[model samples]
Target: MNPTIQLEQQYLVHAYNRAPFVFTDGEGVWLQDDAGNRYLDLVAGIAVNALGYGDAELVQVMQAAASKPLHYSNLYHSQPMAQLAARLVQVTPFAERIHFQNSGTECNEAAIKFARKWARSHFGEGKTDIIAFSGAFHGRTMGALAATPRPKYQDPFRPLMPGVRLAEFNDPDSLAATIDDHVCAVIVEPVQGEGGIHPATPAFMSALRELCHRHNALLILDEVQCGVGRTGTFWAHETYGIMPDILCAAKPLAAGLPIGAVLTSGRVAEAIHPGDHGTTFAGGPFVTAVANVVVERVSQPAFLRHVSETGAYFQEKLQEINSPHIIEVRGKGLMLGVQLDMPTAPIIQAGYQHGLLLLNAGADVLRLIPPLIISRDEVDIAVERLTAILTKSA
Candidate 1:
C-alpha cells in the first residue's frame, strides 16, 4: 500500500473514498503520481482548474502574494479584495456589490440570508419561503442543503432549514405551480453539475426570471461548477439572456484556492449591511491576488473562444465513439456529461489503469470537464483512451 494512502486511511475522516495513487506533481493538464505515472486529466480538479496546473501568470501572482501579508479580517480593507470585487462587478452587469466566502456552500448560504432579509425588509413577515428545483445542487451546508433536495444527502440530516419548496427542474409549469407570494427566492443552476450535467432550457431560464419578477422573488443562480469559463462563457447564465439577482460562484475562482463569491444586484445588496454576514479567512489578500489573475485571464475573449471551439470539437468526438454503453451526451462547452448504460464506478476505476482521470456525475453519467486550455490533440487522445475503456467494459 502507498504510505500516504495508509496515513490517510488511518488519520483522516472516512468522508471521502479517494483514489489510491498520490499525485505529487502537475503541469498543464496532466498530473503525476508518486510512482511518476502521468495521467491525462479530464476532471480538471472537478472543474476547478480552468487554466490547468502550473499556470504561469497564476504562479507569478502567487509568488507575489506569498511575500506579502496573506490575511486581514473583513474588519479592515484589502487592496486585492477590493480590486477583485471591482473586476467582478465590472463583468457582472446586474451586480452592484460582492460578498466573499470560502466555498460554494457559503456563497449559497449568504445568498439565502440576503434574499430572506430583502424579503422581510420589503414584504414583511411570512415571505421567507425559498423554491429550489429537482436535480439541483446548491451546496451541503444546512441552508444550502435544504434547497439541494436529494434524499440521500438530505435524509441523513432531516428537519432541514424550513420554508424550502421543491419544483421540477426545466419544468416552468411546475415552478409556476409551486411558487407563491410566500416564496422569497428561486435558486437554480444554469447547468446542474452533480445532478448528471443537465442544462436548463432557455425557456425555463426565461420563465424563472419572469416568475421571480412577477412574485417579487429573488433569482439566485448557483454557477459554482459551470462558471468561470467552464461553459465557454465567463458565467453560464450569460447564455440564457437573463441576469440573476444573486449569483453564487466558486470552484475555479482562484484556480483551486478555497474561495467563493456572491454577486448581487443593487436591490439585494441594499439588504446586506455591515456585520450582517462575514467570514474570518475569506477575501484574504493572498487568494484574492491570485483570483485577480485568474479572472483577468479566463475572461479574455480569445480564451473564451478557445473553450467554445475546443468544447464543440470534443463533443463531436464523443458522439463519434461507437460505444453501446454511451446513452447520451449533454451539457455545454467543456462541462459535459456522458450518460451510460452501466454504472460508472467500474469504468472510473478502470480509467486509473489506462492513465486517465475521470469523474462520475451521478450513478452512470461520465463527467468530462477538462481544463479549458486543453488542445484538440489532447481531446483526440482522451477520446481514444475513452473508446478503449468503454470497449473493454462493454
Candidate 2:
C-alpha cells in the first residue's frame, strides 16, 4: 500500500473508499501520480475541476488573492465576493441575488431554508413541506439529506428532517400526486450527477415548473454538478427553457476550490434578509477571486461551443464502441453516463492500468465529466481508452 494511504487510514475516519495512488501533479486533462505515471483524468475531481488542473489564469488569480489577507469573515464587505455575485447574477437569467456557501451540500441546505422561509412569509403556516424526487442526490447535510431519497445514504441517518416528501424522478404524475397546498418547495437536479447522470427531460422540467407555480411552491434547481457550462449551456436548466425560483450551484464554480452559491429570483430574494441564513467562511476573498475568473472563462460563447461540440463527438464515439457490455450512453455535453450490463467497479479499477482515470455514477453507470477545456484529441483518447476498458471488462 502507498505510505500516504496507510497514514490516512490510520489517522482519518473510515468514511471514503478512496483510490490507492496519490496524485502528485496535474496539467490540463492529465494527472501524474507519485510514481511519475500519467493518467488521462476523465473524472475531473468529480466534475469540480472544470478548467482542469494548473490553469494559467486560475493560478495567477490564486497568487494575487493569496498575497492579500485570506479571510475577513462575512462580517465586512468584500470586492471579490460582491463582484462574483454580480457576475453570477448577470449571467443567470432569473437570479437577482447570490448567497455563497462552502460546498454543494451547504448550498442545498440554504436553499431549503430559503424556501421554507419564503413559504412561511407568504402563505403563513402549514406550507412547509418540500418535495424531492427519487434518484436525487442533493447533499449530505441534514436538510439536503432529507431530500435525497436513496436508502443507502438515508437509512443510516434515520428520522431525518421532517416534511420532505418523495416523488418519482421524471414522472410528472407522481409529482402532481405528491405535491399539494402544504408543499413549500420542490427540489430536483437538472442533471442527476451522482444518481447515474440522468438528465431530466424537457417535458418533466416544464411540468415541474408549472406545478410549482400553480401550487405556490418554489422551484429549486440543484445545478451543483451540471451548472456553469457543464451541459454546453451556461446553466443546465437553460436547455429546458424554464426558470427556477431558487437555483443551487457549487462544484465547478471555483475550479476545484470549495465553494457554493445560491442564486435566487427577486421574489425569493425578498424573503431572505439579515440573520435568515449566514455562513462565516463563505464568499471570502481567496476563493471568490478564483471563482470570478472561472465564471468569466466558462461563460464565454466559444468555450461553451467547445463543450457542445466535444460532448456530441464524445457521445458519438462511445456509441460506436463494439463492446457488447454497453447498454446505453446518456447525458449532455461533458457530463455523460455509460450504462453497462455489468458492474463498473472492475472497469474503474482496470482504468488505472490503462492510464485512464474513471468514475462511476452507480454500480453499472460509468460517469465521464472531463474538463470543459479538454480538446477533441483528448476526447478521442478518452473514448479509445474507455473502449479498451469496456471490452476487457466484458
Candidate 3:
C-alpha cells in the first residue's frame, strides 16, 4: 500500500470509500499520484475543480487574501463579498439578492428557511411544506436533508423535519399532485447530478414554474453540480428558459474553494428581513474573492460557448463508442452520465487503472463532470480510455 494512503487511513474517519490511489498534485486536467503516475481527471474533483487543478489565477487570489485576513464574521461587510454579490445578481436574470454560505448544503438550508419564512409571513405557519423530488440530494443538514427525497440518505435519520413532500423528477403529474396551496416551495435540479445526470424536460420545468406561481410557492433550483458553466450555460435552468425564484449554487462556484450562494428573485428577496438567517462563514472575504474570479471566468460568453462545444463533442464521442455495456448516454454540457448494464464500480476501477479518474453517480451510472475548460484533446483522451475500459468490462 502507498505510505500516504496508509497514513490517511490511520488518521481520517472511515466515512468515505476512497479510491486506492493517492493524488499528490494536479495541473490543468491531470492529477499526479504519490508514485508519480498521472491520470486524466475527468471527474474534476466531482465537478468542483472547474478551472482544473493548480489554476494560477485562483491560487494567486487565495494567496493574496491569505496575506491579509483569513475570515471575518458575517456581521461585517467586506469588499469581496459585496463585489461577488453584485456580480452574481448582475449576471443572473431576475436575481436581486444574494446570501452566501460555505457549502451547497448550507445554501439549500438557507433557501428552505427563506421559503418557510416567506410563506409564514404571507400565508401562515401551515403553509410551510416544501416539495422536493425523488432521488434529490440537497445536503446532510437536517433542513436540507428534509428536502432531499432519497430513502437511503434519509431512512437512517428518520423523523426529519415535517412538511417536506416528495415529487417525481421530470414528472409534472406527480409534482402537480403533491404541490398545493400549503406547499411553501418546490425545489428541484434542472439536471439531477447524483440522480444519474438526468436533465429535466422543458415541459416539466415550464409546468413547475406555472404551478409554483399559481400556488404562490417559491421555486428553488439546486444547481450545485450543474451550474457554473458545467452545463454549457451559467445555470442549467437557462436551457429551459425558466428562472427559479431561489437558486442554490456551490461546488465549482469558486473553482474548489468552499463557497455557496442562494440567489433570490426580488419578490422572495423582499420577504426575508435581516436576521432571518445567517452563517458564520457565509461570504467570507477570502472565499468570496476567489469566487469572484471564478464567476468572472465562467460567466463569459466565449467560455460558455466553449463549454457547449466541448460538451457536444464529448457526447458525440461517447455515443460513437456504442458498446453493448452502455445502457444509455444522457446529460448536457460536461455534466454527462453513461448508464451501464452492470454496476459501475468495476468500470470505475478499470478507469483508475487506465490512468483516468471518474465518478459513479449511483449503482449503474458513471458520471463525467470534466472541467468546462478541458481541451478537445483531453476530452478525446478521456473518451478513448473510457471506451477501452467499457469494452474490456463488457
Candidate 4:
C-alpha cells in the first residue's frame, strides 16, 4: 500500500473514496504526485480552483494578507472582509449584504436560516417551509442536507429539518405545485454539478422567479459550484434574465481557499439581527484578500468571454469524440459532464492510469470541471485521452 494511503486509512475517517495517487503539487492544469508522476487535472479540486494552481497574483495576495493577520474573530470588522464585500458588490449586481462562512455547506446553511428568519418576520412562523430542487446539492449540513432530495443521502439521517420540500429541476410547473404561501424560499442550483450536469432553462428560471414573487417566497440560487465565472457569467442566473433574492457563492470564490458567502438583498438582510448567524475563520484577511484577486479577474468581460468560448469549444470536442458509451454531453462553461451508458468507475480509474485526473458526479456521469484558465491545448489533451479510453473500452 502507498505510505500516504496507509496513513490516511489508519488515522482519518472513512468518509471519502479517495483516488489512488497522492498529488504533491500542481500548476496550471497539471498536477504531480509524490512519485514524480504528473497528470493532467480536469477536476480542478472539485471546482474550487478557478485559476488553476500556483497563480502568482493569488498567491501573493494570500501571503500578503497572512503577513498582516491570519485570523480574527467576527466581533471586529476586518479590512479584507470589507474590501471583498465591496468587490463582490462591484462585480455582481447583488451582494447588498453578505454572510461569510468557511465552505459551501456553511453558505447554504446561512441562506436557509436567513430565509426562515425573513419569513418569520414578514409572514409569521407559518411561512418557514423551504423548497429545493430534486437534483440540487446545496450542502451537507443538516439544514442544507434536508434541502437535498437524494434519498440515499437522506435516509440514514432521516427526519432532518421539518418543512423542507422538493421540486423538479427545470420544471416550472413542479415548482408551482410545490411552493405556496407556506414556503419561505426556493433554493436551486442553476447547474446541477454533483447530481450530473443539468442546466436550468430560461423558461424554468423565469417562471420560478415569477412564482416566487406571487407566493412571496425568496428565490435562493445555489451557485456554490457554478458561480464565480464557472458558467461564463458572474452568476448562472444572469443568463436567465432574473436575479435571485438570495445567492450562495463559494468553491472558486477564493480559488481553493475555504470561503463561502451568502449574498442577499437589503430586505432579506433586515430580517436577521446581530446574533442570528456568525462564524469564525470566515471572511478573514488571508482568504478574503485572495478572493479579492479572484473576483476582480474572473469578473472581467474578457476573462468571462474566454471561459464561455473555451467551454463551448471543449463541449464541441467532447461531442466530436463519438464514443458509443457516451450517452450525452451537458452543462455550461467549465462545469460539464459526460453521461455514459454504463457506470463511470472503470473509466474514471482508467483516466488516472492514463495520466489524467477526472471526477464522477455519481455513478454514470463523468464531471469535467476544470480550471477556468485551462487553455484550448489542455482541453484537447483531456479530450484525446478520454476518447482513447472510451474507444478502447468499446
List residue ranges in candidate 2 displaced over 4 A. none
Model 2, 201: alpha-carbon shift in Å?
A: 1.0
Model 3 Cα lDDT, one tens digit per residue, 1-394? 7888899899999989999988888999999988899999888888898899888888898899999787878878799999999999988997999998899999999899899888988897789889999888888889889977777888999889888999888899999899889999999999998988899999999999999999999999999989889999999999888889999999998888788999999888888888888878879888889999999999999999999999999999999995899988999999999988999999989987899999999899999998778999999999999989988885
lDDT agreement with native, every candidate: 0.94, 0.94, 0.90, 0.89
Name the lDDT of candidate 2.
0.94
Overall local distance difference test of candidate 4? 0.89
Which pairs in model 2 have colliding backbones? none
In model 1, the runs with Cα more than 4 Å from the true position are none
Q: Cα lDDT for residue 160, model 3?
A: 94
Local error of candidate 2 at residue 109 (angstroms): 0.5
| Greater-lDDT candidate between 2 and 3 | 2
Using all chains and alpha carbons, the TM-scores for the candidates as numbered come to: 0.99, 0.99, 0.98, 0.98
lDDT, candidate 1, 1-394, per-residue tens: 9999999999999999899899999999999999999999999889999889998888888998999998878989899999999999988889899999999999999999999999999999999999999999988889999999889999999989999999999999999999999999999999999999999999999999999999999999999999989999999999889999999999999999999999999999998888889889999999999899889999999999999999999999999999999999988999999999999999999999999999999899999999899999999999999999998895
**Residue by residue across 1-394, what tens digits does model 4's lDDT show?**
9999999999999998999888999999899999888899899899988998889898787777777878887989888889899888777685688888899999988988899899989888699889988887877779999988888888899779888988888888898899889999989898999989999998998998999999999989999998999988888888888989999999999888899988999999998898999887889888888888999999999999989999999999999997899999998988899999999999989998899888999889999999899999999999999999999874
For model 2, residues 28-91, the per-residue Cα lDDT tens digits are 9999999999999999999999999898889998999999999999889999999999999999
Off by over 4 Å in 4: none
